[model samples]
Target: MPIRRRLGYLPALVLIFFLCVLLYAFQLHSLISTSRSIDGIEQTADQLDNYKDEPPNKAQLKLQNSPLENEADTADKALLESPVQDWVKFVRLSDDIFLYSVILDLRDGNMDYPCVRIVAIVRRRQSITCNFAGNSSVAASFYELSENHGLSYGAFVLSCKIPQQIKPETVTSFIVQQDETKTYVNVQYTVTEKVPPSMPLTYGICIPVLYGSRYGAANLVEFMELNRIIGAGHVFIYLQHDRLSAEMIKVVNYYKAKRMLTTLEFKLPVSEQIIWYYGQLLAIQDCLYRNMGFAKYLAFQDLDELFVPYSSENIVSMLNPLFSANSSLASLRIPTRYIKASEEELAHPPLAMKLTMAAEAEDVLFTKCVVRPEMVFEQGIHHTSRVIQHHYQTVALPSSFGQLHHYKNYPSSVSNERVPKTYGKKFLARYEQVISELQVKS
Candidate 1:
């Protein structure tokens, strides 16, 4: 009876225990919910306080800290300013305008600064800058002038870092601006393409001779042989006509076979060939572009002219000091000392004999030259018209160094100082032997 009474009390006691545990759990849950609500209220209050102290917008910040304000300030400053053009007083357009290209060899031992040089011919004593409309401004300046010859002209090479960025097909223009005046003249521009890579030549000659059937065989032989003796690396001759003497043909064939000379035949209708001088200019320019890859220096001259160096026998040896002295030397004008043949020599007529035996200097002409392949663009018969301008002296070689040997007309006065027959004698002898053999064969 006692155990039953205890069991019945146990059920009521267990119910009471369960009810207390459930009430305690609900109180704990309520406490956590109230704490979370208080935290949310505090966060809202902190956000409201932040806005009251300082607005979170750029309008309230300093101008330096605000990009939009800085932009506005810059725009206002620009509006208040005038256009800034370069100063333009001393520079002006040249009366004779010429444009051209050159193949410049920047070879210093292993490092070569080879580039296809562009040039513009102008007239001004002060340095002028060239600005390519959308391209680079020419950093080079005029290093030469024609003031001594009673002419005021300058040849400027257009140089800058932007030329390489120019597309070959892009058609643009350049403006020539004077340094002081900042005055500029605009001209059409055609980008000169770089020549195909090749082995560098020490010296080369381009003789744009207008040859025809009536051309003298002996004169042609002497011209080629003389250049060969002077150590011409390559010789280019443009034959303007079809007919050639047997001796001339033999000489051309001999040099061509030796790979020392190249010949191009120029053929055109009489109407197209109306101007002989223009034809010559075109031929010379063509020869320049053609040989840009093959030569370090190129000389454009007549077949009758020779620049014999007094210091050294060959032209190459004379060039070393000239180049060294004027580091930026592009074109060098060596005075021409005309040596007219005697009447007795002219009567003989071959011309080669006259050159061999001629003595005494009669007239002196001071403006014939050989130019660095990369510094000249358009070549005139007597001198180069367009050259690159750099910060270096572009004076001609002094007459003391050498003078041109021009063989034409009769000697005005005879002197004991006869030209030594020994200069280029070996080549002359070979040419004579070849002509004799060809004559005998014919």
Candidate 2:
């Protein structure tokens, strides 16, 4: 499809043209313009006095670099070239100023091949037209490789082809959202300095969650896994039930036994009104106190789900320092898709749901990752009839690859508890059959 040409496009083009004119104007005048511009009548007396850098505050300078990261002067091409310490600017295709994010090495300036990491978020300003689900701001991130060409700008990373899946629509709202913490990252001195400390990069699995299954082992690793299991971490389960079910009670014990469950209820009550702090929330708190370890991050998902890796880098992340600004929850929205269920899939328990994208409900799935455990509402926040209450609004998802698989939608299910029967039965049976059909190498 051709680019949607609009009146807005003109301004952007014209702005670029005008900015070029300004560049020449600044360079042409040069030092002559700098002198009088600082005076009260021209530049203002305050501007003249303030132009000078204040004496360096040694105490404030102490926490300047992190030990884990290489020294500022290490000469890492990636670190030196990335946007950081005032050398970066974000621009949109339309010439509008878009505030995304850029991180540069803040170490000694004498290094080469500085390790650079630039995560770019692209967004078109146009509003959604059709198939719009409440006009969520579609957005995507691009890893950038930029080179400063002697006052001329040279972009090496942006030119490389980005895979189709990773490209996102221009966000309607905002991203890498502004936060005090993101605004300022500490660039501590070299690791040898013992004044402050630095931490290694830690990650959280983004769970495509569902509520209770009333069955399944409590230990998350016992049933399904990807490579390995954790001793304890946040598991965001989507409890679709308005209240705790008798079957779910048994399920709750599963997590309770592993010391890993936090039951969250997001309802308003049409009939038997259960207050917060009842089942799910109670379980979460119980695990925290009993296990002697609190959940670092809880994925609100169902029992049938399991996370898979989508990127070359085992972990795909959308985390920005700005995530802290929102409430204790981060939204996890999966671009809905589906998987076909076979006859064997339907063979077991009647009404068994499937995890394919087709196994979804009328409502959209914009799950919020549980951050602060204490903040887990017992009754969950408020919701209409069949949805997770939206106490913490959603922030646009950070990636195209950051998604999980859902096994059982109610209509297609052979059994709810036996969910994701695909993995348990279908997949297993299929594997055995394939193996049997294959000729032995011997």
Candidate 3:
């Protein structure tokens, strides 16, 4: 009787187990189906987004069986369009070399590259055009440099080669056009005589600066004024960005309007700025090359570093003695003396008065330099290398005669964090006039 009863319950147990298995199978199938649906939705959403943002022409170009006729039409349309006109700019790098910058806003739109052939119309008499496709590698190298420097976007820095016969000073503008697309951009080149005829071998200062918050308004004014009061006849400033203070702009404009300062704009988007500072080297080189015939002496120094005289009133007076002694000197290496800020000075802040009054110590700083523009083949940040044929020759000026008064050693709010030592006494008393003049101008 017990055996028969156990056999009867076995069928019920089997039935229950089968039902559970069936339920689990159904749930698993539902979950997988839902997951597939979600994946498909996500893929569709991504495709939609890409379609909206990316140009239809770009997608068509990627297709294997894409119609060549359609592509030709698109290219023709692009050639007809002129997007580079707003972004393209030109700077005369030298008599034979021109610097052109084109902002590649590929992310923003489908902007085709300008033509390899660039034309320059000189006084509407002579038209000089060169096939620049071979130099595309140079532009690629500049993009790499910007990436190395920490920039995120692509920019083309074309060291445009001009004919030896065409005087860059006489050329008014450049025309960049894509013949296939019929698109073009006009870049205007300002050909002003920066140096006077009488002062042909003039001394100018080149300061290549990307934008930064560290350059204070009051400081910049005083800096330019001090250099002006010193021996710097012309100031060549390359500003990477236009985001400058009103006071700084005023100072720049004041000198620029008077033709004492040549201001060149560097159009590296703020979003693409890198910290490498190699652009400084390029700027220094560009400045040297551009001013080769214009300026006799080119001083490569920061706005913060001022060349002062010990006994003489100004740098012109100070350098007169050197010129008298060494007529053949191609360059002069001025030793830098770091002037540190005192704790009291930092706290009180004599910005209203002479800012240099607070400087106390005579710390050793990096060497600053002033070189003949024609002799320099290349330029480093601190010093310059001579031409391949010419040997490097520099005269080290004695400290007793005067030195560069660098305000870096001082305990300031901006850069140096080390506790500044008190060395005592100030050497910038002669700069009081310039500083005061800057204060009034500001």
TM-score for each of the candidates = 0.53, 0.28, 0.49
| lDDT pick, better of 1 and 2 | 1
Output the number of the lDDT-best candidate: 1
- Residue 361, model 3: Cα distance from true site in angstroms: 9.2
Instruction: Identify the runs in model 1 with alpha carbons over 4 angstroms from their true place.
Output: 1-199, 212-214, 268-278, 342-366, 390-393, 414-421, 440-442
lDDT value, residue 401 of candidate 1:
68
With candidate 2 superimposed using the best TM-score fit, by how many Å does residue 160's alpha carbon deviate from the native? 57
Worst 10 residues of 3 by lDDT: 103-112
The candidate, 1 or 3, that scores higher on TM-score is: 1
Which should have the higher TM-score, number 2 or number 3? 3
Candidate lDDT values, in order: 0.51, 0.30, 0.47
Off by over 4 Å in 2: 1-223, 227-278, 281-293, 307-363, 366-394, 410-442
lDDT (10s digit) by residue, model 2, range 1-442:
3466666588899999999999988887886666656553553334334322221332332233223223211212222222222111233332211222222222122221121212222222222111112333222223222211122111211111112343212211222222221222222111111111211112222222233343322223322223123112323343444455443454444332332333333221211122222223222322221111122333344443344323322322333233455643434344322233443443332112333334333223533242332232121221111112345444434434443444433344222222243234543443333233332110
lDDT value for model 2: 0.30
> What is the RMSD, in Å, between candidate 3 and the native fold over all Cα?
21.9
- The lDDT ranking, best first, is 1, 3, 2
